[model samples]
Target: MGIFQPLNTPIRDWQGQRVWIVGASSGIGAALARALAARGAWVALSARRREALEEVASACKGETRVEPMDATRPEDFERVRERLLAAWGRLDLVVFNAGTYQPLRAAELTPAVVRGILDTNLLGVMDGVAACVPLFTRQGRGAMALVGSVAGYGGLPKATVYGPGKAALINFAETLYLDLAPVGVSVFLVSPGFVATPLTAQNDFAMPALMSPDAAAEAMLAGFARGDFEIHFPRRFTLVLKLLRFLPRRFYFALIHRLTGL
Candidate 1:
């Protein structure tokens, strides 16, 4: 491991690689699946909608498996994992990208609202990682990519529940990397800036540097190829957010309020 070397093994080749994407039915997950399949990876698509998963699978150019399951269910993860292992013998990469979001303000705070976001964005992600950690550790050769957001970097308006969940996920990915890297299991944290997807369509405010889902998928693949631990983009937007993380609390808060006008 040199100063300039990549943190994880560069995944430049995808031919015959077995990959399971938990949120592969749409958005970045669907785009990634299609891209990887085009590269000849055997992709397994999983989400609550069987029909949606099938639709994405149909669009994929290479080998694909449709495994519909709920992200919030631990049993679903376990079940899917066993099925994948049985079919592929081993999983070279597993991506936990399933998430849900809702714009929330302080005035709209409620337990159900908070729990709904946390269940999919935080708790479900943790549960999925837990299911894979042991298998990856035992195999001593695997990769896990966790899809997070720039919102995790700092607070902003209308992200009361979403922000905290992603913040926790970012921390979780970092901690997972610390424990798993030495064992040959790579953990990648994907922090994307605003990307145009069904998830972001709900936002009423103007989205800066909003990229298409396909572009986001391309960025992620490029990151994996570079073996970057934290893959964030587009740089024009994410760099500013990264800088904000270093500012003093008072200044950071003030700056965010001014920029977002929230």
Candidate 2:
């Protein structure tokens, strides 16, 4: 009915869908898992903390499987994949929501912080893709959703390390979409402005247009129903960020510095 009609065939029904979420221990991932399960999807939860995963899984409606694993580790991804295939036989969707973040300014830049952010945010997403691609290829149908950020749209103050990681992920998702969509697989890059979560709890400044994790989950599901490739939320904030991406480099830098006082 629109430009987005049938991007990868709208997922109108959730019943019996085998969905795996890699960062379901908390925040958006946990909320999404709960929402999908309520709609009759069998959700498999994964995270480094088994206790946290269990806590989320226990609240889910349908059969919820807990598969704890460190997203940054290749062995962990492989192990989780093997177990998922064995349990579900086939996966309908894989949401790569596992990520780490820290307020990193130029003055506070450190090698360890950069490495940790990149490993978890960028490389970790690649690991998920690597593990799931083979299975999806075999089945000839599946979907992958990556959690990027509005910060990735432009360079922001105090986002020295985190912004680059998300930027890389956004670019990676675009490339993956072009490569995988022809083969009957779907790729979605999700960008949320600021959601109230453990990850953003450390922020000192007020988060404009902050939303609850449940709201974020609802927006994601709405995006899936429309079969859109880029799932962004809180139009009041993300829309501005999207517009800024079109400004000239010099003007963009000046405006950002003036706005953020960086």
Candidate 3:
């Protein structure tokens, strides 16, 4: 491959592609489902709410399968994987986008709160990817996209629990890419900045570079077409955060405190 070549095969043709999105009930996942369906991809939508999943499936233009289940449960992932494999024969792409967040500070931390966020955001994604790894490796061709957050790029004041989970997820995606890329399986980490979604609706602080779910989906599609390994959007915002990672700890902490006022 050339030095400037895409890291993975560019997915420009969506016709008849079989895709499974874990958090497709609403937000970015739902938007992506609709976008892909319009391009003729067969989508399978999964989430905890059957009704919501059905609602999204109904809005899709092409074939769609609704697989409602909790992201926290590994059994749920296994069952859904089996169902999709049985029905579609093979999956061309699977996006582990299920995640939950709560604005938390160090003093406000509780076991329940910590577990709730980690179960869905970190452990859920790990297990879901585990379920699909074997199949993707066996098939020797497939794409796995993990929807993480730019917040994972570094520490922040209010994101006590949420930040850690996303940080772990980013690390997980890196390791997965290293292991899977040579095997012909593509691993993509989607680091989205403040996207308007039910999850972000809980934020008490002002979000920078806020984008609609549709806009976020469009950015993701563009990234996929370019075959970028890390598909981060609203570059004006994410690039600043990426740059912050290189600052000295004292400078970074002081800057973050000044910026967030938390």
Score residue 228 of candidate 1 by CA lDDT: 98
Model 2 stretches astray by more than 4 angstroms: 1-4
Model 3: ten consecutive residues of lowest lDDT: 1-10
Clashing pairs in 2: none
- Model 2, 104-144: lDDT tens per residue? 77989889888988999999999889999988988999999
Question: On residues 1-262, what C-alpha lDDT tens digit does candidate 3 reach at each position?
Answer: 6899999878999999999999999999999999999999999999999999999999999789999999999999999999999998999999999988888889999999999899999999999999999999999999999999998999988889999899998999999999999999998999999999998999888999999999999999999999999999999999999999999999999999999987
Residue 186, candidate 2: Cα error in Å is 0.4
Candidate 3 wrong stretches, greater than 4 Å: none
Name the lDDT value of residue 126 in candidate 3.
95
TM-score to true structure, per model:
0.99, 0.97, 0.98
Q: Which digits, one per residue and each the tens of the lDDT, describe model 1 over residues 1-262? A: 8999999988989999999999988899999999999999999999999999999999998789999999999999999999999988999999999999899999999999899999999999999999999999999999999999999998889999999899999899999989999999999999999988999999999999999999999999999999999999999999999998899999999998998889
Clashes of each: 0, 0, 0
What's the lDDT of the predicted structure labeled candidate 2? 0.92
- Where is model 2 poorest over a 10-residue stretch in terms of lDDT? 1-10
